[model samples]
Target: MALGGILEVVALFIPWVTFTLGSQTASVTFLDAFSKMTSGMDSFAAMYVRFLAFILIAGTLLSTLPWTLGALRTKRSAYWFSGIRRRELTPPNFWWYRTVFAGRATVMLLFHIAGIIAMFYEDLSKIGLGAYLLLLGGVLVIVGAAIGPKLTAAR
Candidate 1:
């Protein structure tokens, strides 16, 4: 999951699309393409893309940071909101944690798929490395989320 998050972040800076004219070629990174492409669009579509992008980034960071840190520190997956009340810090319920992670992964994956389809609807071949990386990263996150519970239980 952490690796997937890191990959997704890296992909933002990589070329997502390349345009070639008679003698000139220009490549656009994910960030550039997103901003430029959305600028000329209808308000509704632009808003939706922006919202999805926000969720993708937030979900990746939120899941990755805690999972990476928890694994490194205690070799266990971190539980969200695990003991905010009182002085003692109690571990969260395993089933609840797993459910949350799975649901979050599902949402993220769906958003990624939607974004990919929207961007490449006109020309599938125009899709580039960054887009592929984004898809792979989302898949990895889902795989990690699925296996996280079992790994935690085994430990």
Candidate 2:
């Protein structure tokens, strides 16, 4: 989960869409994806893709926070957490928090649907590297969430 969250955040900076016009190629990320949706007067489906992208980012961050915070409390730098103790921060079992992860997975799935819509909706536009990274980030997050419980249990 932690890895997924980190990856997702990093992927935002990558190029998701590439537009080449008049010999100039511009690459865009999630940040630009939202604006792209607003440029045209009748791009409601594009809006859905833009919205889903934000939801994916939010869901991953929220779902991964507990794990990341717990790790922070234990990596020999509990002092860095100021007043929070390791035991107080780390949950013994992560699967108990399945609802949060489930929410993230749901959003990721929605994001996938939105991505498909965007692909067909903007068939002429060239997809960029960032879009691929975003897809990967979503997959990683889901995979990490699934394996997280086993990892904690193994520990």
What is the per-residue lDDT of model 2 for residues 1-155, given as tens digits with 9 covering 90 to 100?
Answer: 66656666776677766777999987777666666565464454565555756665886666555544444435344334222332332455344344445556657656665764556464635656665666666776666655444334554
**TM-score of each prediction:** 0.71, 0.59
Quote the positional error of residue 121 for candidate 2 in Å: 2.9
Could you give candidate 1's per-residue lDDT for residues 27-139 as a string of tens digits?
Answer: 99877856766455764336545566666767666764454344423323232332212222224444454455656777877877777777678888998898788778777
Clash-forming residue pairs, model 2? 15-130, 16-130, 16-131
Q: What's the number of clashes in each of the models?
A: 0, 3
**lDDT at 87, model 2:** 36
Local distance difference test values of all predictions, in order: 0.64, 0.57
Which candidate number has the best lDDT? 1
The residue pairs found clashing in candidate 1 are none
Question: Could you tell me how far off, in angstroms, the CA of residue 115 lies in candidate 1 after the best superposition?
Answer: 1.6
